[model samples]
Target: MHIVITGANRGIGKTLAGRYRAQGHDVTGTARDGSAEVVLDVTDTGHHADMAAQLGDQPVDLLICNAGVYLDKAERIDGYPAEMWAQTFAANVTGVFLTVQSLLPNLRASQGKIAILSSQMASHTRAPGGSYIYRASKAAALNLGRNLAADLRGDGIAVGIYHPGWVQTDMGGAAAAITVDEAADGLVDRFAALSLDTSGCFETYEGQPHDY
Candidate 1:
């Protein structure tokens, strides 16, 4: 499994990178800080393309768009900073959209799988909004995954969206139910077990599907 992951310098993405590397798979991770195998600021569509080119002609087997943002204490929809909302969408939604869409040719050649990191907050099932920006961004990402699944099905490429659960990362906070290691490991296991027939499902790291 040659995997390319975003936001791999810390949290769940970092954990996933380490796990894959330990399992002897070729893993390329991207971070804006350039600390990972590749530097990728996913908001910059051109940079995403450049990173793909940097990997040469080899097809990436699995691409994980795991970078995201959380509004923290400044959570509000009515009067939140528009810049923050834009930035959040840049990393959370547009970044994932562009990266996956731009890399479709390579993915098609490999018949690869793409996993977009979404959140339970994306769930319209339980929507009420304190973390307005975070929720909206993730919701948009979920829809992005759905659209990609539909678009790429003919290419034999599988697309999925997943929530990492409330993991104990900086974004998830200390009281979150799982650890980064736990969440990453669970997601990897679930990824390996997914069938093409079930590709578009939005699932948790634990493999239970969530309602869109």
Candidate 2:
């Protein structure tokens, strides 16, 4: 698979990139730091379109909208500044939407899959308070995934929204349970097994589908 992955400098995204590349798949990994295998920013909408053009028709088979930020360093929901919510959404929802939209043509051409990196926190049925910014952004991302599934159905592109569990990464923190490697592997396995009938469902890191 020729895949485009965002947030590839660290955590699950980085680990997934390594795994796919090791399997001899062509991978384009993007991060804020240019040190990524391919330097790209999901937040930069213009750059997304440019990269799609530059790819020159060698369309990516999978588009992983994985770039996001957590405002753990800031105040919690009850007393947090409203600006943080905007900033979080800018990077999470808005950035994700732009990245997916920009690469949509390629995905259509390949009859590919779009996997959105959402979180368990986004599940409304299981919602709680706190981490307001993260929760809201992820919720929007989940909805976006649903919308994309509907919009891309004609192109035979499947959309998946998955929660990678609480992996021990920069965002997930050091005390989290799973490792990036384990989460990435499971997600890849789950993704490979999904079909259009299963698109737009919520899935766990271990490949278990979660009902929304």
The parts of candidate 1 lying over 4 Å away from their true place are 76-78
Encode model 1's per-residue lDDT on 1-212: one tens digit a residue: 78999999999999999999999999989999889888789899778878878887778889988987786446544667889889989889999988887777778779999998899999999686588888888999999899888888888888889988999998888999988988988899877875579888899999998989
Best by TM-score: 1
Against the reference, the lDDT scores of all candidates come to 0.87, 0.84
Question: Where's the lowest-lDDT run of ten residues in candidate 2?
Answer: 71-80
lDDT of 2 by residue, 130-206 (tens): 77778888989999999989888888999999999889998888899998888998999877876799888789978
Clashing pairs in 2: none
RMSD of each: 1.3, 1.5
